[model samples]
Target: TTQPPLDDESVYRIFNKLMLEGKVRAAVRFVTERGGGGVLHPSAQAEKRPPGVTLLDVLREKHPPQQQPCEEAFLPCDSLPPLIDVDITESTAERTIRSLSGSAGPTGGD
Candidate 1:
């Protein structure tokens, strides 16, 4: 069924999960695919950091990619990303529920 587009919370949630799971590469890729454009991509830089790359880890502690380096890197602000196979929770509002079941949006007049 259809759902609403991704929001800042959605992006941050997924990003946080990936970081906690130690899926640094996956997190970077996820952000990139979402709208990060790659230059400001988050990096464990495992090779560059030489086993002490805790940038994402540190950011994980800060959270939600707001007013931070990691946030600027991969967190999109200008545009919405294309929906991926994200495990969307049942947080969608009533409008989405209605639309998915084929009900149109509100009519202008009864």
Candidate 2:
């Protein structure tokens, strides 16, 4: 089955949800893969911050840094990193189907 591309807005929604759930640490690891080769190519980075203030600082002010740093905060006016397409190979898709079907070819069962 072909997977639909996750638009930028979708990524922001997911990452923003993670932030609200207090799961992202330091920086959101936005990974993307092209051509459906099943390889992830994450290259997004947070923009540079002004002197005396950092992403951590802003996060702290908003949510009081929970042990780990918040990866994405969905700041009021900051632009989000670009989103890329992810592809799934036929073999990988088949494997996933098998696993979900509980076939466990060779391993018997887990």
Candidate 3:
């Protein structure tokens, strides 16, 4: 059987499994530039890799109530920007539309 394409969800599940299997160091490095441990926020304490403790274990210990069901992850380029910029000039917009139409196919006006 063929393997499914490695989409974001698959990547996330694989990472979670790796972390659960005591590969937290590898998991963190995959998402961040820091290795082993690092700071997540300016005010937050720096992460420490305690003996025999995984990052996921630490997180669950700290925020048991906030734990959420796993969802899909995505590459940075896979999503659209939160905000969009468009030129509001009517002439510019019209010109762009006309140009696109010209390239799409022959028009009846020909």
Candidate 4:
């Protein structure tokens, strides 16, 4: 049996699933290859694999999530800015704070 062409909702669902699984390149590929033409392979990687495995499943599993979310900084610790010790509570504005607009007090009209 042949699979029907994917609709917008189905396309979005597949794309989101790949993205959330942290497979950006695969997600883009899926949209470009499958979405652009709706030509899903009849049986991508069917032989020598599990019964229900799919192309998307293989792409997502190619890279583990634990290894995907790190910045590309040479010295990661040095890239971060130092924390500020200063405190400014909104309820009690610091004395140094001044209204950016007209003076908080009434003008000469006061």
lDDT, each prediction = 0.64, 0.56, 0.60, 0.67
Off by over 4 Å in 2: 31-110
TM-score (all chains, Cα) for each model: 0.28, 0.25, 0.23, 0.30
96 Cα displacement, candidate 1 (Å): 48
- Candidate 2 C-alpha lDDT tens digits along 1-110: 99797898987787788678865541154433321333223332224755556555665567864576476854566677789888999998888766552225434442
Cα lDDT tens digits, model 3, 1-110, are: 99665778877887798799987766766555444442344334435764666556666678768555555553446666588776689888666666552224234231
Winning model by lDDT: 4
> On lDDT, who's better, 1 or 2?
1
lDDT of 4 by residue, 3-42 (tens): 8989999999999999999888679878888333333574
Choose 1 or 3, whichever is better by TM-score: 1
Clashes of each: 0, 2, 0, 0
What's the distance in Å from true for residue 74, model 3?
Answer: 43
Ranking by lDDT: 4, 1, 3, 2
Runs in model 3 lying further than 4 Å from the true structure? 1-5, 33-110
Question: Best TM-score goes to which candidate?
Answer: 4
Candidate 2 lDDT score at position 18? 68
